[model samples]
Target chain A: MDMIRRTVLKSAGATGVVAGLLATGMLKPTLAYADDWNKAAFEAKNMDGALDGIGAKGAADNKDLLVKAPEIAENGAVVPVDVTSNIPNTTSIAFLIAKNPSPLAAQFEFSNGAVADVSVRLKFAETSIVRVVAKADGKFYSAQREVKVTAGGCGG
Target chain B: MADPMKIRAQMKGDVAEVRVLMSHAMETGTRKEADGKLVPAHHIQNMTVALNGKTVIAGQIAGSVSKNPVFGFKVKGAKAGDKVAVSWIDNKGDKRTDEAAVA
Candidate 1:
């Protein structure tokens, strides 16, 4: 018990030091964690570019990957999207709005026996194809659904 | 500062259905305020979920997501009485973490 307490205290002290460095601007905020935000991927203007930015180029269409989205979104500002993959050993799932100024919307990585299921709300600039890409077994599979946005979400 | 996320976890059979509601403006950095100045990009950049202290989902999000984003996922082999913790870090370095008991 004494050893565990000491270890915990040491970790706490280390965290405090890191936080202090961040507060003083000595350390970049993104470097505080292992996972860094991929800004370029999310800023890509086209579907292919976005996929390439995320190292998911040449993804093949697969029926096992399912993307569920509204056929017609009354409010383009908030469209619900859900994706599920039946493929085994799925590692990641990413959503893209093909017509948005920036196509990549969200990307999720799964581990520890988590199911390949994700639901998120996305914004659409206009009528666009909602695409979902799943990485499994070192390969990428994709599925898409067209969602007609009656109103634009990017502009007033 | 942002409001704490609301997380719910329930065991359906052996699967744990986790739902999270994150309170954020999700500003795209393009919108103009009343003063006609562009609002800087401020959105959740990363999210994580853990079941019984084991990470099950890690997500990277962008400003294209809708405001007050809602996310849902499923975790296999999760049982009642387990703990489900959800956390998110925004682009501005703000973070919030909240947990729920599996039911």
Candidate 2:
């Protein structure tokens, strides 16, 4: 069981590199990607960010998306998260941390008749915005919440 | 190891309540040891739950979850003694599958 979990963990870690793949062209650019559903703002410290990083600036009133994080993270090293969406025709979802080593956490895309709920664990170096964004039909919508990281959880 | 996933299934009328506890360190690739070496990022990537060989739930994931991830969902028209299977594939292509029957 440990062996299996270890493998899963290692694969889960590959997103940082997969997100980097577009930059190095280790993989082909997503020529088929649609712009409206593909957000770019939330990705970087600046505008020229990765497609996965962009999100709507504010979604305080968007009623379809649900974001959950502790008001205070007991361990900054590993924080728990849960996201769910009830928006019609939802096509994508993403998670971003305003103050991680990198802002991007993870992103997911849904196909025909897919469920819009997800949960995962992440690392936070400090207090940051926990943003969950969703693309519905042809428009982008998002919600940002804050998390306070107390102690670090990385191997350190 | 954080903790082995806790799995449970119950029946109330025709509803089945299924739950899972997955063990994961969920490292975010942004920390260092006392000696200052960066710890690699690790997390669970994909998970699917099936009822009696039919797909019921599937989701893409990343490392933004807590240690020992837990998820519960509802299934309609399920009966007691039906077999429900859960499978997970992490970022590195490691996959594990577990099954439980409704009681």
Candidate 3:
């Protein structure tokens, strides 16, 4: 009876594993849902090219997008940036450092009921406007704040 | 061996707040050492978060990210005891994965 019970437990565990995978839709190829990282955007030397690369070329400034960053960053090597968007259905948030060798710092895509809030530390080449662009409902909205750096982080 | 990434996932009113701290040098490849050799780019290029084996967040990060980066986000519908995992791939193809139980 003990051996039979052990076998039953093993099959139950296997069934649970299969059920979990089915419920999570893991059997499907979710790779199509994930957008590939845009290398061109990160390598763009100019803001326009970077913006165009990410399909955010004509983003309009929106008040709902809140960017929390220090007005004066004593160490350019590490600047803390917090971005929050109240716009409904936000799908992504991107960071751009105007004066960095590569203007695009990071791009984040939200899925599976993730909220539209992100925090990251970025390096700055010099004092520059830090821009946060949020995509919601297939429209791009952006807001910028100037952060003063006492020392450049990008080998200045 | 490199240190394991530190991760925390706590549920608050059906939303799991996930925070991850990864240890890396994040060299931008532009900095020169005292010997005048340029540091090769060695930063996390991709990161992803999964809840209960389902991806919730995926990100592309550049070398501008600071060394030992920290990231935080929220995932809806996660509860206490749910499995939350975080993984990252660096520019040199080094990868790390760590998991935590939502609390």
Candidate 4:
């Protein structure tokens, strides 16, 4: 089980060099990526800002959305989270960590008959509520699950 | 050039299940190094998945994602041998794209 998750781990030294270059103004990131990344939402500082940035401030809670995560995460570094929306015509799904510095962790827009299901790993600073919000037929619905982080607990 | 992304695509019934592992540091820009200097933020900001050259999943990822992020998604109407491509661009302007055939 651990081997599966650990498979992606590799030396990050190359990325560190890129970071240094960007910091020193040696390399410039193209503005072309701005159209795809949601800067407003990802840079939002608070929960309210995050919700507003995603345009889900008044989202209604729904049971059709499923958020699967470990009740207690032994490690906060790589907590696996899976989300599935049974609601018809789900156009998008967004994952938000209630207490994260930016709250809005990730968001995916689905189209061309793509299923509104996704699995991803997230880093948690501490125990926090994992919120899943989905948009279907122009209406926003949400569901949340609390994941407890046990410090020093072993994870397989 | 950036490291190649590991991509796997398989047909689960009629839907194609695509999973990808991107190589990144996903720095939060708030962490302090041993020298007490802030680590600059460097994370995947944009990602996209395409089935047979058609867009299926478009996403925005942040530093909150774990390092070497793994993502799984399913696409409908995909058949065996169909092409699946995954691509991403980080905040530092680094980009990577890899493709796999659905089996």
| Whole-model lDDT per candidate | 0.85, 0.62, 0.84, 0.86
lDDT of 4 by residue, B1-103 (tens): 6789899998888888899999999998878899999997888889999998999999999999999999999999999888898988887667888999999
Location of the lowest summed lDDT over 10 successive residues in candidate 2 chain B: B58-67
Model 1 lDDT per residue over A34-139, tens place: 2466777987889999999888999999999988898989898899999999988999999999999889999999999799999999998888999899999999
Clashing pairs for predicted structure model 3, backbone only: none
Q: Please tell me which predicted candidate would have the highest TM-score against the true structure.
A: 4
DockQ of 4: 0.63
Expressed as tens digits, the lDDT of each residue in A1-156 for candidate 4 is 233212212212435464554465534435355356677788888877898999999899999999999999988879999999999999999999988888899999999979999999998888999998999999999999998887885543
Q: How many steric clashes does model 4 contain?
A: 0
RMSD of each: 7.6, 9.0, 12.8, 8.7
Q: Candidate 3 - CAPRI tier?
A: acceptable
Native contact recovery (fnat) for each candidate is 0.81, 0.21, 0.76, 0.86
Supply DockQ values for each candidate: 0.57, 0.29, 0.34, 0.63
Ranking by lDDT: 4, 1, 3, 2
Clashing pairs in 4: none
Candidate 3 or 4, higher TM-score?
A: 4
Runs of candidate 4 exceeding 4 Å displacement: A1-29, A154-156
Estimated TM-score for each candidate: 0.86, 0.62, 0.83, 0.88
lDDT (Cα, tens digit) per residue for candidate 3, span A110-148? 998898999889998889999999999999999999999
Question: Candidate 2: misplaced stretches above 4 Å?
Answer: A1-61, A89-92, A106-121, A151-156, B1-4, B10-17, B74-79
| Candidate 2, A20-81: lDDT as tens digits | 53354423222111112222342254212533344444433477788888888877656777
